[model samples]
Target: MPQAVICAYARTPFGKHRGALSGYSATELGAMAVKELLERAGIDPASGVIDQVYMGHVLQTGSGQAPARQAAMNAGLPVTTPCTSVNKVCGSSLKAAMIAATEIRAGVSRMVIAGGMESMSNAPHFVRRARRGEEVSYAALESVLVHDGLKDAYTGEAMGNAGETIAGEHSISREQSDAFAIRSHALANKAWDEGWLDKESFPVGGLERDEGIRPDSSMDSLSGLRTVFSDGGQITAGNSSQVSDGASAVLVASEEAAEEHGLPVLARIIDYATSGVESHRVMSAPIPTVRNLLKRNGMSMDDIDILEHNEAFAAASCAIQMVLGVSEDRPSDIPIPFRNPCTVLVRVRLAISGAPDQLSR
Candidate 1:
């Protein structure tokens, strides 16, 4: 099989609620990130190098038309370059990248641009067509962002409620959740301070750093945050992931293309698989999926240097940790650490290979 490698990537700093990025639409942010990636790598999308563009988006809200095509055109890519949008919820962009890689591996596309975008702050409310009436009476209006994004149609369970249920099953406590949030913020803050993320971040609307990190946050402050779901639930506003806005993109190319263009390869494409958990226990899907990925690769948790799980709620990370028998300490063992910033959490298991020695150091 042919190989596809991610040559370069870029992303905009995650904007806080109604922050600087509010003015731009999700498609614009996505285009900005992709353009930045191409600029840094000196690749011209109009040069016939890019074969296709794949974008993942969860909520379009006010953004109109085909977001992927809009994003590619917005990024100055030739209109002739075909584009497709993938909406796999949280893993939309990641899945978009996977799709791009698959196309390259299948020998169909030589080079492709893949990424995801979201504008949670701009999520719009709408009234169904059936709700419209000739009378000037108030019709029922539903929040498309909330109902379609967070609420499960099958069980009508809000994502927060699902987190609470998972917490109860795994005995994850509020204190533990708080601690995990604190650690995450601390790590994020440290990374920002060290300028480790500068390589991948693009300046957008004057927001250069992640707006969600609370450097001064402590256990006391976290403990005081009210529970967001159940009356006695372990999930709290502080422990739960923030509703953020941002976009990211990566340039995937086949081995021949990469060598011809003199682009350095970071990692090779490996096996990818997905699984579905019960609607009530949706967060546990990663447990079985990761297990299957590892099993297919003939490896286990001990063999994985890094296992990046999307932390939608503190309970989610805890539940995955418990089921996978993985301790948090092992993450540092990997040479490249991934910090995912997305509302929907997609479990990605990357088996690192072919990284330069500078990264290992």
Candidate 2:
């Protein structure tokens, strides 16, 4: 059985909603990341070295057909290269990488490009039944981002409402949530200031750094914000994820292919697992999923040196920490130490092979 390893990784600096990256489409952003990733890996796009390309995209309302193909061709990949677009909502890109790794481990592919892209700034609005010419006097234009991407289709509730439910169930207070949000922003600022994040990032549209970090955020400022989801809700705009646009790409290649091409192995995929919970408890799914993954591999929470859990909402992050028994003393344990500006579907497990070093440049 072949093993899959990440040879290269690159992402565009996250642009705040309608900010620097607003002009670029999701496919264009994906193309930028894919181009840089191939260059970093020293692979020629026309050489047919890559067997496939998989890109995850959520808001595809206005984007043209075959998004992964559009991105690959825009990045100079050969038309012969296969492309797939995946959408598992918040886990879309990670699922893309997981599929690529599965194919490589099964000897179905030698080399693959896997990543995700999103342009919430460009998510379109449409009037329902407009195409069918419904016999209605007025049809309100609905936001695709809010309706298709952020809302729970099963329950017809916004994800923030789910966050509120999770917070209530887990006993996460508003103060705790606000503090976590502050820590996330502070850590992101620190990482950028210390030049740690720049190593894995590249310029896009002349934007050199993430545009969303608020260095001046504090408990006082966060406390004043009103609840968003429900009356007296714990979830607030300050504690929820920012609506940002960005793209990330990574080269997943078989160990044999890496050795042949002399590509540096950044990390190896040991094992991955997926689990689900009740639709309303969407944010809590990671808790059981992570536990199952560790149990299957005969590992424990203590064995994980750095867990990059996505902070979709500060409430969710607090819930996971409380339920998992993650040690607060562990150095750089989770996103609290390395939170990125874009808080959407970006999931990467960095368990280096030998000595655990900073993610290689």
Candidate 3:
């Protein structure tokens, strides 16, 4: 069956944890993006064309229906529309979109909304190693698990530790990682300056600016920072994407539905896949996913016009880039954009809080 087309897409500027959007709940962020997407498509949220609402969330603390339902209701979608919550780690949003597209292809539904939200600033924290609670006296055990107690069930470690392991195993040097991070910042800055992203982002609580771009960046200062996970480990705060708070949404509709509604198509997923690797080697999952995508399309790296891997960690990003035979170095042997990107953004926190605005040098 022909793929569904993306009618509209919108995202809150990924917010640095506790940054400008600390006050807004994830539902609010999702709702804001949903509303903007509908407006972009010239449709009202109450339009019954929407068949389902899928929300991707990793960290959440509250009692109620899934965040997807909350977001849909808050965005003013019809209450009768069905909703589902999906969790695929960072791939959740894309997966949700794919599912909606599949449903459209199967004649299950004509249109749907899919996307994600994560608020690291408000992520629930809990006592360390609740499994060890048995070792503590019975009287003291109950209180220890308080405060939305939850822990990583796999390694009994936090996500940051997993990131650290990815760095060490990949042998991604701190210098190299920091350099890649600077490039991300520079590319993002350029993308903003050139208006490549203007069409994709929405205002949140009146925030119009991207909170992540740094005006000043330098390499010298970045190379001097201390490592975060292990002594002498290559990864550092400068090279990692901050635990961010933000949300994004995209509208998908069948070709017939699009014609009926008079909506424009942005792009369609030609092919997509997801895989699971060892939890400790979580960063490696994308490698297989990309390979499968290429295999299915019978295409190569050179065929792709753009690659948007989540920069979960510098080490993970670099490792995947190299394994895929993608070059980070410029053809001239010098970084394409001239400037030290690390020092410029080490302290700049980006997040969702306002409308999209130009970031000047």
Candidate 4:
């Protein structure tokens, strides 16, 4: 019975781009989340039980050597702890936790830490001429910060532009997309006001709550905004994911190890999986991923109670909804860093285990 189990989870409140978290390095932000995870697990930082650290990140420009290692060190973990950095774009942190679960299932490591951190504002611009080895010429400094998330590798299309493409391909209208955005913001605002996020969120960089939700957002305003990616595009700032800064983390271990450490089982990691899509439709990979997960687990979309969609683009979520036939599910499109699946897993337990009081938030 030594299967992988999640014992504790925590996340820093998401900050806006160039907002509260802009000045800190990714390692520093990750360290705070890691420390909180250890605290929630009731395990000492110096405990040798932690076998490794895995962190996901996208904007790694100017982030120092072995970023995860640095984050663990900064969190007061022993230098002997191994660390690995993963970059799978939007799915980075989610995949990192899945990999940790596999390690626990394989019995290679009992206790491990997995999470992700991102600081879009702090991502550095680079001097490309230095790398190209030009002898003498006035050259412009290019920024990976700008290009990394913006440009797709296969077609050089910006993520927003691709969102527009998906929108056009799927025939998702501006009204429908705007409705999703408005509802997402409303739910986030309600969650913040009701303090549903307090258990999982802690203050970082002087920010105590999610900084991205627009409290005054309305359909009228969203309808008026011009599309930035293409002239006739349906995608706009209102309908796309807010560029954000924050981190989320969880402590995972085998079931036997959890008993050994006297830790409560927050959730069990089950049947982690992934799938691919056509190169051009990369944003919609979650459709096949959800289908494969359900099929292998011998379940259907109707068997599920809740689905939390990380908001990347309204179009992607809408398209996936149409494909997966889960459009009727209650809205749980939590923001990325503050709303990692580790917390979702825990919430699922609370919601289903008759803990109504706890699930009310």
Question: Which candidate number maximizes TM-score?
Answer: 2
| Candidate 3 lDDT tens digits, 5-53 | 7777777776665788878877787788778778888887776889998
| Sequence-dependent TM-score of model 1 | 0.92
TM-score of each: 0.92, 0.94, 0.82, 0.91
Question: What total of clashing residue pairs does each candidate reach?
Answer: 1, 0, 17, 0
Q: Which regions of candidate 3 fall more than 4 Å away from where they truly are?
A: 125-152, 329-361
What is the alpha-carbon lDDT for the whole of candidate 1? 0.75
Q: Name model 2 segments beyond 4 Å from true.
A: 135-139, 333-345, 349-361
Which residue pairs show collisions in model 4? none
Off by over 4 Å in 1: 130-139, 332-359
Structural RMSD, model 3? 7.1
Report the error of model 3 at residue 191, Å. 1.9
lDDT of 4 by residue, 97-123 (tens): 888999998888999998888877777
Q: Whole-model lDDT for model 3 versus the true structure? A: 0.65
Clashing pairs in 2: none
Error of 3 at 31 (Å): 0.8
RMSD of each: 3.1, 2.6, 7.1, 3.4
User: What digit string (tens of lDDT, one per residue) describes model 1 on residues 67-144?
Assistant: 888989988898899998888776677788789889999999998888887777788887666545634324566776
Model 2, position 239, has a per-residue lDDT of: 80
